[model samples]
Target: MASKQASVASFVESAPPGELSNVVADIKALAGNDASLLQSLEPAFRKYNEEQYATVKLPGSSEAVIVSEHNSMGDNRYFDTASQTSFQVEHSSQTASAVQQHPLESSNADLIRSLQKSFSKAAAEHFPSSVVGIYPTSSDSDIAILLVANKYSPQNFWNGRWRSTYTLSPSSGGLKGAIKVDVHYYEDGNVRMSTSKDVDVSNASGADAVVREIAKAENKFQEELNRAFVQLSEGSFKGLRRQLPVTRQRVEWEKIGGYRLGQDIGGGRSK
Candidate 1:
């Protein structure tokens, strides 16, 4: 079993630019809308969160920042600020497999690997201040008991964090039997019910009864994963911006602020 770190590192370092399209296509093929790669990454998060880990990268010049921002809007809305892409390239007149078979052919695989290494080195040099490990994702129902702290009663939407993440390969039985349980954070900072089968984030039979049960029970989880799945496979999210706060009929943020009411502030105004 290749360490997920090694695999991720490889993806970051060796993936090619033009190959992103094909890679995304391959991911879509594998998870079928399992966007953000979470469809295949939750298992790793569960296992690694117990003992967090991170790369030794510096900031400023780093190519990407593995950022972690918390949204306490009674929901966990966390996402990686790191660049979300990976790819492999084939430059010569021959395919990668052909290159491998023909050994001595001048190929693009080497160039691809070189590019990835450069990116990786740049990342480590710049993002030295970033978190070492334990990006978050959640399963709402499992944390039902510890609700008061959030001031967020079971609303129509999910009230948990999202980790826009991915892994080199799907866990367990590929995507089918991947055993990543959803983790519930407590209002009091305790780990709540970590359910075995993410009520909504699982794949059961296509039977109507099963789908219905999964829907009612894992509504939020299912919805979020589905959205990410779509975003990752489809290359973008359909953003619906939140309504801006109402502006007082005459209130202006810029105009009044320039005029200070203090001493000599408006001296050259209207003599």
Candidate 2:
């Protein structure tokens, strides 16, 4: 039991983002419906969710310690911080099979594949190291595409990621789509923002045309999102925080403690 638990921890610690579900599924298979064991793993998952990876490692796998940023592109990146060795992790055959059989691929496999190819090409060109995945939705005609871009700059004390999901489906106009964009920018501190918008792809007449239109719509959507992010970062956020006190500065309570001292009347302070 101890060995099994340690193996579970090892997998969780070394597993990269976009591949954790597969890890969990494999662990569950070994545990064989052990509810308590699954429940006990919650803390490990929570720590990973909180982006705590300073001590992440995979024992007996590599002599060098692995340093990974949560959701960062490329697995096993910067495996050794001292020498700065960038190690790329190879997926096991079992893991590869799990990825190929993603639950989302069960429905509308062809459409999902089409969108995956289109988005993957764009991602490779425009957003290097990003991962693109397409999934089928409950609705037969609706499909969802998820694109993740992550990076970390330790020298600058910042780590950030962009997660965008687009849902495309048939509509009266032509092809209807909606996009949800989530950004987390952590520089000295974390600042998160999310936004969503609905878009229309017109003039989608045939099957091939529909694919082309969807791709075009996604490009346009990304452009608009880019502008909006810039505005928020350069204009709105700065304006809102310009007057705020610096986070690192200490407050001198002794100096201003008596400035607004409440008046005592009849042994009680006035409201």
Cα lDDT tens digits for candidate 2, 1-271: 6677667877775554334566778877988879887766765654453332222323323222222242223432322222223333322211111111113324556555556566667767766556554544545566545555656554564444555554555343255655555444556676555566676666554345555665566678788877987998899988876453444554456765554444421234657
Which ranges in model 1 have alpha carbons more than 4 Å from their true place? 1-197, 200-206, 220-251, 261-271
Candidate 2: where are CA atoms >4 Å away? Answer: 1-112, 138-141, 169-174, 202-211, 225-271
* CA lDDT scores, all candidates in order: 0.28, 0.51
Q: Record all residue pairs in model 2 with backbone atoms less than 3 Å apart, i.e. clashing.
A: none
TM for candidate 1 is 0.19
Q: Judge candidate 2 at residue 182 and give its lDDT.
A: 46
TM-score of each: 0.19, 0.43
User: The CA-based lDDT of model 1 is what?
Assistant: 0.28
* lDDT accuracy of residue 262 in candidate 1: 46
- Model 1 per-residue lDDT tens digits across residues 1-271: 2464446434432223123234335545765664555334433332232111112122233432231222011111122212222111121110111111112112223322333344334324433322221112242211110000011122322222222121111122111111122334434454433222332234422223222332344345556667866885566433443234233144355776765544224345444
User: What's model 2's lDDT at 152?
Assistant: 52
- lDDT at position 20, candidate 1: 27
